[model samples]
Target: MKAYIVSLAAGVAVGLLYNVIDVKSPAPPIVALIGLLGMVAGEHAIPFARMVLAHVTS
Candidate 1:
């Protein structure tokens, strides 16, 4: 998706900027990735749950 690509690009730009400045990420790689995974899962899960609830009620 365009949004995903743009977000990825922005993240890469920020990462490169951080690298250029010799600044470490706020969170370690593994921790940050796990957090990202949780966020993605949560984003989908909430919408899916609502859809299921609507279907069951209808």
Candidate 2:
């Protein structure tokens, strides 16, 4: 569907932005995947943060 494609693009865009804005290091593929998942779920930016939290707490 068109919406799916849009969400996918948005996810990649988010990942790219993260890579640009984050001073620590380059964004990983997993980070992009999480962003994509967030897009699909209609969760905006919170899911990406949750993913990072999960990684850090693990």
Candidate 3:
């Protein structure tokens, strides 16, 4: 929860900075969010795969 709050605050700060600089964000918001979701899923996937492999071998 704390991490989520901190990330939200940081995102707000970056948004304000982008408005001040008058430049478009590198990636559209939806695309960037999807990328973040992919990263999180990928991180969990490795551990899940390892667990399945271990179970199969045993």
Candidate 4:
């Protein structure tokens, strides 16, 4: 719950800033969010795969 609130607050703050600047969003928000999710998953997956392989080989 706390994490969700923080994320929502940060997003709203960024949106407010962009509104103040009068600049359009550079990319689609959903696309960018998906990319971030991919990044997080990939970052953790590589280490997890290595651990699994190491255990199997040993």
Candidate 5:
């Protein structure tokens, strides 16, 4: 639960930082949401890739 909350806060901070950097854009919120999802997916993918690599090597 705590990790989830921290992830959420980090995502929000990333989103806000992006918006601040590109204040003229109108899609900051969507970009932020996509970024959050990407982060989660990427995290899961790393271990999956590592497992695959080990299996292939062994």
Candidate 6:
């Protein structure tokens, strides 16, 4: 989606900037990536749980 593309572009830009500055990234890359994954999963978690609960109750 558009949001995903924009986020990816922003991340790439930040990465390039970090490389140019020769400074360590603010967070470890693996940890940051996992945190982002958790955020995406968390966004859907509530809606998916509600759908399942509604089906069960119906």
Model 6 over residues 1-58: C-alpha lDDT tens digits?
9998999899899989999999787866897889998999999999999999999999
Give lDDT for model 6.
Answer: 0.93
Q: Please report the candidate that would top lDDT against the real structure.
A: 6
lDDT of 2: 0.79
Q: What's the TM-score of each model vs. the native? A: 0.52, 0.39, 0.48, 0.46, 0.40, 0.51
- In the predicted model 5, the residue pairs found to clash are none
Compose the digit string of candidate 4's lDDT tens values, residues 9-52: 99888888999999787757898889999999999998999999
Ranking by TM-score: 1, 6, 3, 4, 5, 2
What is the C-alpha lDDT profile of model 3 across 1-58, one tens digit per residue?
9999999999899989999999897756897889999999999998999999999999
> Whole-model Cα lDDT per candidate?
0.92, 0.79, 0.92, 0.91, 0.85, 0.93
Tens digits of per-residue lDDT for model 5, 1-58:
9999999899788779878898554445877889998999999998999999999999
Question: Model 4 segments beyond 4 Å from truth?
Answer: 1-28
The per-prediction tally of clashing pairs is 0, 0, 0, 0, 0, 0
- What is the C-alpha lDDT profile of model 2 across 1-58, one tens digit per residue? 9998999899788778777987443545877979887777786467888999999999
Candidate 4 lDDT: 0.91
Residue 19, candidate 1: alpha-carbon lDDT = 99
Worst 10 residues of 1 by lDDT: 24-33
lDDT of 1 by residue, 1-58 (tens): 9999999999899999999999997856897889999999988998999999999999
Between prediction 4 and prediction 6, the one with superior TM-score is: 6
lDDT of 1 at 38: 97
RMSD of each: 4.1, 14.0, 4.9, 5.5, 7.8, 3.8
Give the Cα-based TM-score of candidate 4 against the true structure. 0.46
